[model samples]
Target chain A: MTTTEARPSKLTPRGRATRERIIQAAAELIYEHGVQNTNNERIRLAAGVSGSQLTRHFPTKESLVRAVIAWRADTVIALHKIPQLGHLDTFASLRLWADSYIEREELCRGGCSYGSLAGEALKAAPSLRPDVADGFERWEDLFRAGLTAMRERGDLRPQADPDQLTHLLMAAFQGGMLLNQAADDVAPLRDALDAALAHVESFATHPVPHDDATGGEAP
Target chain B: MTTTEARPSKLTPRGRATRERIIQAAAELIYEHGVQNTNNERIRLAAGVSGSQLTRHFPTKESLVRAVIAWRADTVIALHKIPQLGHLDTFASLRLWADSYIEREELCRGGCSYGSLAGEALKAAPSLRPDVADGFERWEDLFRAGLTAMRERGDLRPQADPDQLTHLLMAAFQGGMLLNQAADDVAPLRDALDAALAHVESFATHPVPHDDATGGEAP
Candidate 1:
């Protein structure tokens, strides 16, 4: 419920740019050092803003973190909007997505901000919950849109539930990233994606029976 | 690489109980606050030990975290040894695991301690990479063993590679956790597990035919 309510920019046009640069630095610091470990002073030093300036702009650490979460959500969720996914093979698109994920990993250095923040905030700050929670919901929508597009193009089984598949795909991708962090390697991500891609491809060769009952299928 | 090297309680039995209490307190604090964020002073306060007494028992934070990780490894990994997993229906066993995971989320409120430490450590300290990496490798191995045993029992696709499936499963689980954290809900984990269990069931029902390049219909 807390927010940066200040409507006025603290600095001039050039000063505004400086403010953004400082915010970016603070975000990076937050990503690198745990938010609790990172403080206004460290953020100021890292961002090259005066301690007074940092406080004037951010006022509180929560506001600073919220800004970062918004930015990250925008970038991570941008994948679904890239046109021409309609033409790409599912595996090709997934590989591209994987490569992009690698870029994100490098940028953050071993952890997704969402995962880290969610864990940290869950235990400490109850306020940040809404932002993180909302981000995931949006993420699911992004995937659902993409899968729906594929279904419309006949790349997916006619009876396939795009919404359900979206959940599954995102789940695996998220899990893969977590596993990659744990193993401190990317092989798990690759293996998981490869297995998933193969299954999607196999769906082309052998479709689930159209008349198959939902509940009584093999347990 | 820094070890705490606390002396085993050579003191009265009462002293041993106190030491254990102190260690447990430190673990909770470290999990709540980042390892670096938590200090001996705070730990002493939480544990009700004198600052000097806390220092006498455990000299460093790294050593305390190490102790927790070591203890967790022994206890949590032992959970993987449940036999006859292959004999259980995929749905039944998966539901059990999934439910346990949800329960964990409820308990931690934030996520997982092992995951949190790995994320924080890998980001801030490069030296801890080895410990974090080794720990996850152990986790992956446990998963691999389960998949392997199940495959041996004909509970998996004939050509399913246990290692590959293990990776996929791990990825899904981790990814789901991330999504769970982001959404502040259990849907991601639940949805992903549902897909995985469904995929296995779908796959087991239709094994791919062996190639007969010799122009003979081989049974």
Candidate 2:
């Protein structure tokens, strides 16, 4: 069946539970071992589901991968929406947001959920590029929403473009994570976020004082 | 056999030619299909080499992957070293370097050579992480060397850190390419590079006139 036709919303309560279990198992396996290595049999064993159940929920590997992408996107979106971290309208809040990502040991170690998936998807599953793209768009919108709020509040200069700034931050984040994954260090990520933040800060209507403790210089 | 022992330098002229052919074929396949999908048999077939020849050159997949990583790194380094693009000491030259990458249709469409390899290497070939890390370090040094020149010339502010700025630029380039691949568009890459260049420009001792035509605003 097509991914659309197999939507979880159409399933019964028990079926939905089974599907969630399968997706959770697959997501964990994919994150640990990547999409190519995580096969149906392993996922079946991990989820404690029978072969029939997996096929019933996700008839194709592509469908399962799409679910995992959606799952990762949801998890990231939820994390970003945490009350203290959601607001990006203020410079302090933005810095805090950047710090929150840098401080996530799991993210530093495992790489970004979307970024890891994007690489695999782009290489092996080109059809899913749009799904990954959608996830990024939603993620970007989260930042854009906050920056737009800053613009509306007169916190950002008239010439500053929130959309463009969001792209820069997203680039910093994705690129930094890739470097982190390669080098097995967090410094690249921190530097990237710092640079993007410094760029964002340069557009502030009333520039925030440089926090010497953070080691981020004024743009 | 270990990759070190199988070094191309140790081979005779014909053997070295054979090895180069295999690596060239594998690199093309890996870039097009990815590491997981490019198997030894396919590589042998594509390279027009017999099974024994392929096995002789690369006893294991990891060995072949390492060779491919080195090949891609050398190619990228050579491209960056083209006299016109090599110097990053000046603001104008830095902009040119960023533009050259953004204008490469193949990179935009197929994704970056190192970035694509980095993702697969980080996931499937943990043993090759150091190799990829070394490649990135070398790439970063290219930019760092130029920024250092700027610093030595008193063109950069005293407080500006060339090493950190190099990280930021690398982040923008890598992250922009990933976003470009996912979104199937070039604007994200352009926006990211523009933002990074603006950030780099911010550190200039005597600011270059903002090129209004490029749409990059002063930081």
Candidate 3:
């Protein structure tokens, strides 16, 4: 009843399915109830897996949390992988990225998965810091790559600092999501993203002016 | 052993002190361990209170969490009450407020107390939403008041929207604190606040141009 017997690459189709189920259940539970409140027993019950099966996949809650972080990182990165959000070199695409999060808030009825992890559980669990930090760094890398593209395309001013802007965008995003969840409203998220985007947009060379009267699409 | 006989106004001096001690202990414990992991027994042990004494002040753990939310709000608001931060009519005072939070991060070694509460435990404890929400609203009001003062002074353009800017600033703050705590670095928080203040500065009527080279004092 240990992972030693069945490594991920060596697992049978059914074994892989079972492991995925358990990890998904654990992620949902941790995302909702938090890592500290969640237990192996509850995850087992929720996943409808036997004790041996649970132990075979993830013997410890810490291991399971680490898996959930990887799992959630995939889910989040996949959202950004969509063609529009993937490049994020254009104003419309950046708005799409913001909208995607607002859509997620409507579905999850909570904050960003990463924000929840970082704000409470990650700090409390020192051992999990690297995993969480890696996930966030990957998130920042995505935006950095996008901004780099914008700069190369002459869409952004030559003076714009992509590294600093990337970090600023991430901070605004994490902050926006936290406030949105706490207030159970989307306005805060929208305002934060809009302001951050405007800041980024300010650095555009030959910027297209936004219509002041209609509050038209960002240029 | 419940608070059946003693009320806040009617409490003797000793009773008040004991209650404050319990609340202060609970706040620290919750801030450190979160509401889910920190239980009644731990609170009692940490506060050095007997079961009867603990129960007399807070009959349930939920009540204690609510009290901690209120107490932390008071602590956070008190920091902003300093004359410079109370009315952020000038750019200098806003930087002071932002810097105060950065100084706090160096000391606290965690995210904003309110941000942590909202991200995890408060969401799990649905019954405590109103209390936590009210606490956040009060924090927003502080910023709103300051922004309103700026508008009244003709420092901000007539087009400036204080209410929307208030919400935006709060979102950036909570978000920035979160990233800073997670990365154990101050750069993200600094970037976020500087970006937010720059956004506000864009609204100044008779703008003072900052000396770009020296990183001179904010006007």
Candidate 4:
């Protein structure tokens, strides 16, 4: 379904607020209990909206789930603030970005929000795969833009591929989070990011001095 | 729950066969449709076993899920045949191992079987986290053993940390497969693995000749 169909153009300010409230409630419920277990009734109660209101905003559960996917994508990008930072062209900024993700207590505990939603969507609602895929593509694009900037600025080798590197970084982050979820530890996440960053560092046009790079004492 | 508790000691040959059939059926069901969607009745029907027989083997759904996790771990190792090939000491063997996983059609379609189950189990059955973690630990150990062999054989640098590298490899794999599932494409999986392999290659004591390594014509 298209965005216009899912969200009618006739919404007043109050109607928009109500819709946002419902979507927020549904997103949290789905995050905690998964898509299969979270029903419209539960969402309605959680949102403090009536069944009719819920139905008015979302014609079907699929539409609501799609809305949640879209909402989550926006929320994730906002939370990352990568777009706000503009370009992650320098190695230090890249390291900072990686560290910011690693240091998040919520990620260590609950795993990546996008990944959790995507995982459940893949299983319970196969039809929504495109929406989930769109979310990931958007997220990857943010990184790809930064990496592209690096390549153009000559911080990366002339032949270094920003697109491929973006995929590698995203995979490492997603995979590390998955492992973290399974192991109930953050070490896997840390190690995975470290390895990916090292790989990226290998492509630096002028490698950072070892001591400056690692912050380690002189050998 | 402990293994001994999950699987009772006393069972005749027929009873054992029934149990195996039930687990195999449950595993397939879980693979095709996640843990939340696959019910005991469906598994029983698929296995062609009576309700009583199913209950006798796995009194609880949790027990059966655990059995599936155990079965999946074993099946994944056997399928890889890495242990049978002994050490992945040489870079060529490592490349072969990575290629074998990438070339699998089932992986392209269904994603990594073990990863799909783990993803579902993480969301649907939080208590089964330990079982999933144990399965991953076992899988990582297989890779760690190979890396350790490479280091001991002087193919890798003396200071190379097998444990950390194993984490990176496993993270890339799980992450790559997760991306593959979301994108419905194998390129992400390939890119992730290629990046991880390149990272691993950086540790080689005597780097494979560029021409011999990549099989590309001379520059």
Query: lDDT of all the models against the reference?
Result: 0.62, 0.85, 0.75, 0.80
Residue A41 shift from truth in candidate 2, angstroms: 1.4
| lDDT of model 1 at position B145 | 70
**Candidate achieving higher TM-score, 2 or 4:** 2
Number of the candidate with higher DockQ, 1 or 4: 4
Over 4 Å off in model 3, which ranges?
A: A1-7, A103-105, A209-219, B1-6, B103-105, B209-219
| Candidate 4 structure quality by residue, lDDT tens digits, B1-219 | 543333545787888888889999999988877888899789999999999888878888888998899999999877656553555666776767777777774765666789888877777778899999999998888788889999898888876778778888888888888888889888788888888888888888885754355321122
Model 2 lDDT per residue over B1-219, tens place: 345336678889999999999999999999988898999889999999999999989888888898899899988988888888757778878888887877775767778888888888888867788999999999898899999999889988877788779989999889899899998988788888998988888888896875665545555
- For lDDT, the strongest prediction is 2
lDDT per residue for candidate 1 within B115-201, as digits (tens), equals 666666665566666777677778778666766666776767556666776677666766676567666677666666656654555
**Residue A6 of model 3, lDDT score:** 47
> Against the true structure, what is each candidate's TM-score?
0.79, 0.95, 0.91, 0.92
**Fnat across every predicted model, in order:** 0.64, 0.69, 0.54, 0.70
Q: After superposition, how far is residue A183 of candidate 1 from its true place, in Å?
A: 2.7
Task: For candidate 1, write residues A86-173 as lDDT tens digits.
Answer: 3233545654555566545553345665566555554455677787777767866766776666667776766556555666676666
Model 2 deviation from the true structure expressed as Cα RMSD, one decimal place: 2.1
**Second chain TM-score per prediction?**
0.74, 0.94, 0.89, 0.90
Candidate 2 Cα deviation (angstroms), residue A95? 0.8
RMSD of 3: 3.5
